[model samples]
Target chain A: MTIITILDLLGTFVFAISGSLVARNREFDIFGALVVAFATALGGGTIRDLLIGVAPVGWMLDAKYLVAVIAGVGVAAFFSTILLKLRKTLFLFDTIGIGIFTLIGIQKALAQGLSPGVALMMGIVSAVFGGVVRDILCNEVPLIFRKEIYATACLAGGTIYLVGIHLGVNNTVAMVACMLLIIGIRLISVMKKIALPKI
Target chain B: MTIITILDLLGTFVFAISGSLVARNREFDIFGALVVAFATALGGGTIRDLLIGVAPVGWMLDAKYLVAVIAGVGVAAFFSTILLKLRKTLFLFDTIGIGIFTLIGIQKALAQGLSPGVALMMGIVSAVFGGVVRDILCNEVPLIFRKEIYATACLAGGTIYLVGIHLGVNNTVAMVACMLLIIGIRLISVMKKIALPKI
Candidate 1:
C-alpha cells in the first residue's frame, strides 16, 4: 500500500523482465531464463543483506516481490515483441527502480549501523550489481565495470542523499531528491552515450 | 593451529593461485588479476556466509586469508612457467582444498541451524562458487556448471557427512570421511573424465 513498497515490487518486476529478455536473447532455455531472471531481480538485495547481516533477506519476508518477478518473466515470455516495442518506457521505469533500490539499500545499511561510505557503496551495489551479475553469468564483462555511467549515477544520488541527511534535510525530501537525480543522470547519460573515461 | 584452520588457509592460497594463473592466461592486467584472485580465494565463503547470515563475512574478520591470496597472486606473477610445470601437484592440492571447503561450509550452515538440505547446498557453494564467481567475472560459463562433476562430488561428500551425523557417527570421523571421499571422487573423476550427463 505504501509508495516505497509499490516501487520495490515494480522494480523487481522490471528487473526480472530485463533479465528474462537477456536470457532469451542468448538462446537460453526456459529454466536458464528463470534462473537469470531471479538472479537479476534479487541478487543485489541478497548481497546487501548478507553484508549487513540481514537474515532471510528481504524477498524471503515478502511474497509480493516473488510474485512480481514471476509475473515479469511471464510477460517477457509471452509478449516479447510487444515488450520490445515498449523498451523506452520499460527503461524509464527501470531507471526509477534503480533509484529506489539505491535509497532502500542505503537506508537498510545505515539502519544496521554501517558507516556512510559503506552505505553508499551498498546503495550502488543494490542498484546495479544485479545486472552486473546477470552479465557475468551470460559470459560478458559486467557492463558497469566496462562501460556506462550506471553505478556512478547511483553513487552521485547516494552522496546527495547522505549529504542532505547530514545537513538535516527531511528524510522523505532527501529520498525524493536522490531518486530524481539518479533518474535524470541515467536518462541524460544514456541518451548522450556518456561513459566514464576508460583507463 | 588446528588442522582445519591450516587447511582453510592453504585452500585459500591454492584457489588464489589458480585464479591468478587464469587471469594471466587471459592477458588481464595486474589489477584485473588481483580482483580475480581475491574473488577466487574468498568469493565462495563470502556467498555461503551471506546466505547463512554471517555478518562481515569470514575473511573480513581475519587478515591471514587476504595475505594468502596476495601471496598466491605474487607467486603466480613471477613464476607462471614454473607454476605451469607444477600443475599436477597444484591440481592435487586443489582437490583437497575443495573437500575441506565443503566440510567447513556444511559445518557453518549446520551451526546456524539450517536444514540439512540447505547445508549441503551451502557446502557445494562454499567449495566451488568462488571459482564460479571467478569464471563469471572473467566472462566464461562457470566451469562447474558446464564441464565437471565438481559440485556433485561436494554434494556426495556433504550428504555422507550429514547422514553420518544422523546415524550417530563420531563428528571427527565423519569430517575426515567426507573430505577423503570428496578428494577421491575429484581425483578419480578428473582422471577418468567423468561428468554428469547433459540434460
Candidate 2:
C-alpha cells in the first residue's frame, strides 16, 4: 500500500475516534456515536470533493476509509477511558493528520486545475472542515474559527508546498517539508497557548 | 419562464433575506451578513448537488441564484425595520420556499437515479439544510433540530410526492400537491404548537 493511503486511513481513524469520544461524552447512543464518527472522519473530504465537483467523493470510492472509521468508533466505544487518557498522543496524531490532509487536498485541487491560491484554501478546508462540521453538529462555534490557530498552520504549510513545487523541489521533499511545518506549528501553538489576534 | 424557475428564484431570495436578518440580529458586518445570506440561499442546493455528484453545483451554473441572494442582502441592509415588520409575510414566503426547495431536491436526486426513499431524504435535506448551515455559521443549534417541526413538514410533503409519482401521477400535479401539503403543514403546525415526540 502507498504511504499516502496509509496515512489517510490513519488520519480518518483518529478523527473518528475523536468524534465518537465527543458523542459518548454527550451520552449519545451507539448510532449517534457512529454517525458523529463517520462525519468527523469523512466530512472534510466530502466537502472538498463537493466543492471541486468530484463524483462519488473519496470515501465512496474507497471502502478502506469507512472501515477505518468503523474501527475507530469501535475502539472508542470499548476504550473511552484509555483513549481519553492518551489525549496527548492522540492530539499528536491529529496534528500530523491535518498536515497530511492539507497535502492531499492541495494535490487534489491542483490536479483539478485550480489556481494555487484556491488550492491552498481547499487544503485548509480539507484539514479543518471535518472538525467544523463536527462542532456545528455538536452546536458550537468551530474551534479552528473561534480559538485555535489551526487552519493558519495548514495555510502556511500549503503555501510553502506550492512555492516549493514552483521552485522545482522534489515532490516528496516538498510534501514532507510541508507536513513537518504544519506539525511543528500545531505542536508549538498548543504548548504555548498561541492564538491569532482578534479582529 | 417556467413557474418552477420563478419560484426557485423567489425561494432563494426569501431564504437569503431570512439569513441576513439573523446575521443582522447578531450584529454581523455587511460582509458577514452577505456570506450568511449566500449560504442560506444556496447552501441546501449546493449540498444536494454535491451529494448527487453534480459538478459546479446548482448556483454556479445559473447566475440568477446569485442575483437573488445579493438582492436579498441589499434589501435586508437598507430596510431592516420594514422587513422585520413584515415578519408574518416573510414567514409565509419562507414556508413556500421550503416546499419548493424540497421539490427541487427530490427531483434532482431522482434524476440522479437515487432511490425514492433516498430522494425523499434529499428533498428534506434541500428544504432545511440551508437554515442548518446558517444557524451553524451563527454558532447556534439548528432551529429545525432544536425547536421547530420544520423538517417534518418537508418529510410529509416529500413522502407524498414520491408516492404520487409511484402511483403514476402527472409530474406537475405531484409537485404542486407536495408543495401545498408542505405549506399547509408548516402553517398549521406553527399555529397549533405541534412538535415531534422527543426521542
Candidate 3:
C-alpha cells in the first residue's frame, strides 16, 4: 500500500477504536458499541459525501476500510474490560484520532477542489461530526458544543494545512505539520481548560 | 408571502410542531425539547440542501423558518399538558408533516437536476430522517425501522411524483397526487401494522 493509504487506514482504525471506547464507557452492549463505533468512524465521511453529491460513500466503496472498522470493533469488544483500566491511554488515542482525521478530511476536500473555508469546515466535520452523532445517538449533548476544544482543534489544523499549501510546502510535510498542530492545540486546550464563550 | 413561500412556511410550521410534540412525549426539558423540535423541523431540509449542495441551507438563509420553529417550540412548551392529551391528533399531524416534507424534498431535488433515484432517496430522507434523529436523541430505535411503514410510504410518494413529472402533469396536480399517495399509503400501512423487512 502507498504511504497515504496506510496512513488513512491507520486513522480509520484509531477513530473506530475511539468510538467503540466511548460506547463502552457509556455501558452500551456489545452490538450497540459496535454500531456506535462504526457510525463514529464513518458518519463524517458519509455526511461529507452526501453533501458533495457523491454516491457510494468511501467506506461503502472500499471494503477493506469496512473490515478494518469491524475488526476494530471486535478488538475493542474483546479488550473493553482491560481497556477501561487505562483511561488516560484511551484519551490519548482519541485525541490522536481526531488529529489524524482532521488532516485527512482537509486533504480529501482539497482534492475535490473545494475552497479553503469549505475544506476547513469539512475537516471539522470529519474529525467531530461522528462524535456529535455518536453523542446524539447516545442521548447526550454533543461534546463539540459542551467540550469545546475538539472542533476548535480541527479548525486550527485545517487552517495550518491551508497555509502550508499556499506556501507550496510538500504534501507529506504539510500533512505532518497540520496533524501535529491539531494534537498540540488539543493537548494545550485540555490542559489549560480553555473554553469558548457560552452564549 | 408568495404561494410557494406560504406553502413552504406551512410545511415548516407543521414539521416543527411535530418535532416539538415528540420532544414533549419524550419528557425532555424545555431546552432539550426545543433542540429536538428544531432538529425535527429543519433537519430534513438541511440534509437535503447539503446533499444537493445548496449553499447556506434554506433555513439558515431564511430567518423566518427559524422563527417559526421557535414559535412552535414555545407553543408546545406553554401548552404541554393540553397538547399531550391529544395524542391521536398529534399522530395525524405528524403523518401530514411527513407527507408535506416528502413532496418538498422530491420537488427540490428535481429542481436541482437530480435523477429520480436520487430524488426518491432525498424525499425519503426529508420525510423520515428527522424522526430517526429524534428517536436516536430520545434513545430509541427509529420508528421507520421498527414500528411502521414510514419510509416506504415516502418512497411511494416519491415514485408517484417521479411518474407524474415524467408524464408532464401540471405541478399542482402532481403535488396533490403525490401528497395524497403518501398520506393514504401511510394510513393504510399503519392500520394494517405493516413494516419493512428487517435486515
The DockQ values of the predictions, listed in order, are 0.17, 0.17, 0.09
Instruction: Label model 3 with its docking quality class.
Output: incorrect
Across residues B1-199, which tens digit of lDDT does each residue of candidate 3 receive?
7765665666666667777777666555554565577678888887788878774456644568877788887777677677668767766766777777888888889889999899889988887887777776666777667777888888888788789878999978887888788889888987887777878
If scored against the real structure, what TM-score would every candidate get? 0.62, 0.62, 0.58
Model 1 residue B70 CA deviation in Å? 2.3
Where does candidate 1 clash, by residue pair? Answer: none
Q: What lDDT does candidate 3 reach at residue A54?
A: 57
- All-Cα superposition RMSD per candidate: 6.5, 6.6, 7.8
True contacts kept of each: 0.28, 0.28, 0.08
lDDT against the true structure, each candidate: 0.87, 0.86, 0.75
Residue pairs with clashing backbones, model 3: none
Q: How do these models rank on DockQ, best leading?
A: 1, 2, 3
> What is residue B180's positional error in candidate 3, in angstroms?
20
The clash count for each model shown is 0, 0, 0
lDDT score for candidate 1 against the true structure? 0.87
When candidate 1 is compared with the true two-chain complex, its DockQ is: 0.17
